[model samples]
Target: MSGEWQHGLLGCFDNFTLCLISWLVPCYQFGKNAEAVGESCLICGLGFLVPVVDIFLAIHIRGKIRESKGIQGSLIGDLLYWCFCPLCSLVQEAQEVGGAPQAISMGRE
Candidate 1:
């Protein structure tokens, strides 16, 4: 029983990081407007961390949701692979693309 509790705790933590990375990546990539971006981050955080899966929540954001279901609530997220796998894939791609054996030569600054 205690072991199960610990596992659950760890799973929640994993989801938290998933939310953070997923929320931040697109925000940084798109350079959205400040107000909307801030609001979106807060909203996504709530859904991701809580494990509530943020079903069709129309009232909280006070706007019609572009899409309601969260990461785990969706097909991919339900597969237990939030975004870390993609991040790992990106790193793998980088390593493949002349990123391996990278040597940094320091020059006089």
Candidate 2:
């Protein structure tokens, strides 16, 4: 696996609207990232409600995204990323999973 994140964390200005949304409603942004990678939005969203567990869950979701997309990253990196800058991490995942510029559709076809 040798892929990289499509967008940088601090490059939120690339999508100012998403940056605002991410800053305002991080859980919602995280939920969108989770759904994009085929995780349960409700479950992931709920995880963020708890402070301690949210870090672990965020790392788990990031790992899922990395694995699914063949992106290169480590557990420590994920932990640190979520620990220090969760909003940027969420936005990065959203970009990686192609959910940044669009709304996450919950309805099944």
Candidate 3:
């Protein structure tokens, strides 16, 4: 695993399906991300209902992902992503954990 986000915030458009999923159902994306990093998806899904706590939990989940995957990042960076561009962050997380686009496609075969 790389020590960084697989895609930049603005690069979400590169994966339209993931971008749309993140945009239309952010909580679902968050839950998926949580599951990928060995966290409790149910707790994350429930946390999304609370505004402030959700942001913190999202950051925590991102941190855990980074730690588990050896992704290099700082709290400030996590805060910025979680606060200003959560959908992009979620899409990036999905891409990283789910493997490359080709790898994901191959799995369905």
Highest lDDT scorer = 2
Candidate 1 backbone collisions, by pair: none
Evaluate all candidate structures by whole-model CA lDDT and list the values in order: 0.29, 0.84, 0.79
Q: What is candidate 3's lDDT per residue for 1-109, written digit by digit as tens?
A: 7666767767887777877777888787788788888888888978977989998987898888888888898888899988888777888887777722332454544
lDDT of 2 at 108: 100
Candidate 3 TM-score over all chains jointly: 0.82
Model 2 lDDT tens row, 3-81: 8877887777777777888788888888888898888888888888898889888999999999998889899999998
Candidate 3, position 73, lDDT: 89
How much is the lDDT of residue 95 in candidate 2? Answer: 74
lDDT of 1: 0.29
Clashing pairs in 2: none
Query: How far is 67's C-alpha from truth in model 3 (Å)?
Result: 1.1
TM-score leader = 2
Report the lDDT tens digits of candidate 1 across residue range 1-109.
Answer: 1211112212323344433443456322111211232346455434434433532221232121112212112343323322334333222222222222234789877
Give the better candidate number (1 or 2) by lDDT: 2
What's the TM-score of each model vs. the native? 0.21, 0.85, 0.82
